[model samples]
Each structure stands twice: as structure tokens, then as C-alpha cells.
Target: MPNARSVVVFDAFGTLFDVHSAVARNAASIGPASVHLSEIWRAKQLEYTWTLSLMGRYEPFWRLTERALDQALARSPEVDPVVRDTLLTSYRALDAYPEVPGTLARLKARGARTAILSNGDEAMLADAVASAGIGGAFDAVLSVDRVRVFKTDPRTYALVEQEFGCGREDVLFVSSNRWDVAGAVAFGFEAAWVNRAGVPDEYADLAAAMVVGTLDAIR
Candidate 1:
């Protein structure tokens, strides 16, 4: 959004990484019901974060993700501990979107410092980055675990400033999540909504400076 060079801070889950693949990775165990399980698990996982944020009773994303899986699995005909464990282990590495690798490379070629601000635990993020083969592409990976809270919170945004030594205007925050984009905009960062699904921005008034269909439009 900023014409001048700026730091790029990305949201990890739905933005940089493909969360749906988290369950899909366990397809061998989940079988034909994988899509339903993924949808339930992902939805509840986010809902739990918001619930925790509102209640001020924060749990690590890993625990919350597992809880979401449990809730989704409870509706199934039978439960397999091995299957659940396999799904939980799958979280350690999920696939990145198709365009992500090249997008980051281009952002770096033009001299922008990049970092990932995620709800994921450190090990979760580490494994994801490593699995994606893009660990070297990031300047840093920040986690809400430090503050023990979830995102769309001002404190989560502040972690970027605290770690990167930059001001809101000098940073371009990007996320596929409208709430996250709104939170960064509310915190004064120039933001771009990577509207991957082509969904309308509910907070159009608060608004990202640019709303692109993919990260390819970022530069």
C-alpha cells in the first residue's frame, strides 16, 4: 500500500499458509469425510480463538486446534486415537498457497523486510515454514503466545513494532482475513486484504488500502 519501501508483516494461517490442508494432510485417516472435518475443525478453531480473546482465558493455538478437531470428530461414527494424533501432528506442517513462494521472493528482491505474525505456536510455525521451504524468506516469525492472546487485538499488532522497530505507516500488513486487516488498519498500519475467496469486505469503511485477489498484486 505504501509506495515507499516498507516492512511486510503477514498473518500466517489463512494468509500465508493453507489451513484447509491441515486436515487434508490426514486424508488417509479422515477418508471421504475429510472436507467436512476440515471445515468444522477450521471454523471451530477460529471461533475458539475469538472466544478466548473475549474471555481473557487464552490457550495456545495448538491446544485450541486439537479441541476443535475433537469437537468435529465427536460427531463421527467412531473415534480413533491414532487418527486424531495423526491429524494433530499434521498441524506441524501445512501447505502454503500456490503463489506465496514467488510473491515473497519478489517482495524481498525489491528490498522489503518480511515477517510472519501468526496465532500458531513457535514450533508450529517453524515446521510450516520449513515444510514450505520458505523459512529463509522471512525476517522473523512472531507468535501470540508471547502475549498469550489471539489476533485482531492491538497487542498482537504491537508485537510487530516491538520486534521490527517500525511504525504503523512504515509497515504494510496483509491478510486474507478481513478482521485481521481491519485490526491492523485500526492500529494505523497501511494494509491490503488478500481477498482470495473474492468475498466482500464487511469492514469496507475501515478498509485495506488495496484489496487484491492474491499476493501477486501486492507489489
Candidate 2:
């Protein structure tokens, strides 16, 4: 396996940015009691992604986000329409995780190239990077729009290798999602699970090369 010298391709949502905050903001629009709605919605969204991935029926992340949000709202009658729309707007501008800047800086200082490989469309990612004031933090920002499939698919994972012009083993795939870490490992990339929630044992069978509480740990 290639070491840290290899390019690091990170998953955007949950790994580098906070998608939950956006969901919460939107859920609040419907009703005052929707505090935990965003979290539940996020979990369901990820579950849907995994389910679709296994079923071989792939859809764009944006579509999934909208679908997940709609379903989540359907279950809760108090969500307001105006608030929901505003929350959707907030999603396009999610703040970066607190550790993202320092961790990314450390990697860059070490001469390690960094990039984002996400299910987010290029437009959404561009806005997010700009909003987070870290557009330059990444060497490349990859998207799944070209392939129309989510992560774990060979086409989506292959972008890292293609962009950096490196072999699969020469890239270190980092993600907060266990399925993503597993997929990277399966694809021959040195995988690291950013166990931000301390869920190392949850994905233990995937054999992630490394597990860390923060990106700084890996850097």
C-alpha cells in the first residue's frame, strides 16, 4: 500500500462538512419541534444511499437529498413550507467541519496533495467550498455527476486515480461513512475511516487501513 505521500481524496459530506446543520435548519422551518429532524433525515438519506447502491439502482445525490427530505417531512406534519425551502438553500452552503481547516493545512504543509471526491454536484460543491472560505484548500474537487452513480461504484472511485494520474493503490481514500471506507478498500485504495463519532467497530470488517478521530490524526 502506498503511504501518506499518495494523494488524499476525501469524501465531502460528513467527512469535511456538516450536512446535519443544514438539515436541522430546514426542519426548523416546518415546526419548532424539528430539532432532531435533520439528524433522522440524514441517517435515512445515508441508509437510502446504501440500499440503492446494493440494489444497483443509482440516483444522483441531489435527487436523493430531495427525496429523503420529502420523506422526512412527510413523517412530520409541523414542518413549515417556507422554513423547508430556506433549509434546502442552507444545504448548498454547509459550513466546513471545525477540524477541516487545520487538518487540510497540515496535509498541505506536508506536501500531500488533497482533493474532494463527493456525491455532490460540482455546482453545489463549488458553492460550499467558497462559502467555507477554503476553495483553495483542495487540489481537485471531483463529482459523481459525470458517471451518474454514487460512491462505491468503480466509476466514481476511479476518478481519484484518473485525476491525480496515480494507481488506485497510490491514493488514500478518506471518508466519515463506513460504506465509503469499505468501498475504497475494495477498490484497492488505501482507505482511512474518519471515525468522527467513535464508530470504529461499526465498520471493523471493512479493514480500513487507519481509523482516526480527526483528519489531523491521519495527517
Candidate 3:
């Protein structure tokens, strides 16, 4: 639970936005492999981030996204190269989850300061927020690009305190990705795991402060 002064920081991809919707939007062109492509693309994107961070190397998340898509396309050769451009373009404006706008509004109406702390690059976050028409909802959109790394890294999580001058306990970090919520918990933030899929929890030692089915359930 967040206190009145707690800044509600959301993870962008799976929490606020429906990342799989990019492939769903172009399903007609992707054919039966659409689901596999989305799964592989997302998995590889995160893998690349961790791999790069371990190697003390960095690539902008946008580049990792493209590289991951290429890998997914290669694995699903049934998907035509022609739809590649369409899929990539759709990622820039991926659909927001139905409750996002109203939830953000309610939080703001209650005087909570909201923000997004994402692995997405600045430009990617800007485009997605603009496309969702929720560009003004956040007080800050902190990207890992600022630190040249990705989440699970303490430096990435540190951006919250850096931005708001708040202690870890003064933040409620929300993410649909359990690993992200675990990372926030490890960093000492009051974390909420938005378990939209009703999946069993992992990272038992670093459990979230709360778990909810959706953003609307926060508070």
C-alpha cells in the first residue's frame, strides 16, 4: 500500500501497455505463428538486456527490440518478411491495457505523483505514450537508457529516488513482470505485483508488498 506522498512508478511494457498486441494487430499477416513470434520476441529482448549487462556492454533497447524481432522472424520463417515493417511499426504504438488511463487519473485525483520507470529507451517510451494518448499522465518517464543498463540492476531502480528525492519506502513500484516486482522489492521499494495472468509467484525470498489483478486494484 502506498502512503499519500508515495510516488507510484509503473513499469511500461507489460503493466501499462499490452506488449503482445503488436503481434495481435498484425496477426492476419503473421498467420498461425503470431503467438510464438510475440513470445520469442519478448523473451529474447529481455535475455539480450541481461546478457549485455553481464558483458559490460550496452545497446539501446530499441536496437535490442529489433534484434530480438529478427531472431523471432528467423525462428518463425513462415512469417513473411513483408509484414516485418508492419510489426515493428506496431510496436511503437502498442495498445494500452484498458484500465490504464482511468487508473492513472484516479491516482492523480488523489494527489499521488505518478511516473514510469521502464527499460524502454526515451524515444520508444515517448512514442508509445503519445500513441496511447496518455502522454501527460506521468510526472516523469525514467528510462534505463539514462544509466545504459536494464532492470534487475540496482542502478536502474535507483532512478526513482534520483528523480523524486524520495526514499525507497516512499515509492510503490508496480510491474506485471514478477521479476521486475522482485527487483523493486530487493531495492527496498514497496512493490506491487500486478498478476494479471494469475500465475504463481516466483522469487519467494523477495516477494512483493502487495499483489493485485490489475492497475485499478492499486491503492
Best by lDDT: 3
Estimated TM-score per prediction?
0.92, 0.88, 0.97
Off by over 4 Å in 3: 1-5
Worst ten in a row by lDDT for model 2: 24-33
lDDT by residue for model 1 (65-104), tens: 9999899888765545458877776677787998999999
Candidate 2, residues 2-120, lDDT tens digits: the string is 35755888999988888877865554345565765686678777877778877878777777887787777777676654555677788888878888899889889988889999988
Provide the clash count, candidate 1. 0
Candidate 2 clashing pairs, residues 3+ apart or interchain: 29-83, 30-78, 30-79, 30-80
Q: Report the lDDT of model 3 for residue 61.
A: 94
**Residues 44-63, model 3: lDDT tens digits:** 99999999988989899999
Give the candidate number with the greatest TM-score.
3
List where candidate 1 sits over 4 angstroms from the true fold. Answer: 1-5, 78-82
Per-candidate local distance difference test? 0.86, 0.80, 0.92
Residue 8 local lDDT, model 3:
92
Order of models, best TM-score first: 3, 1, 2
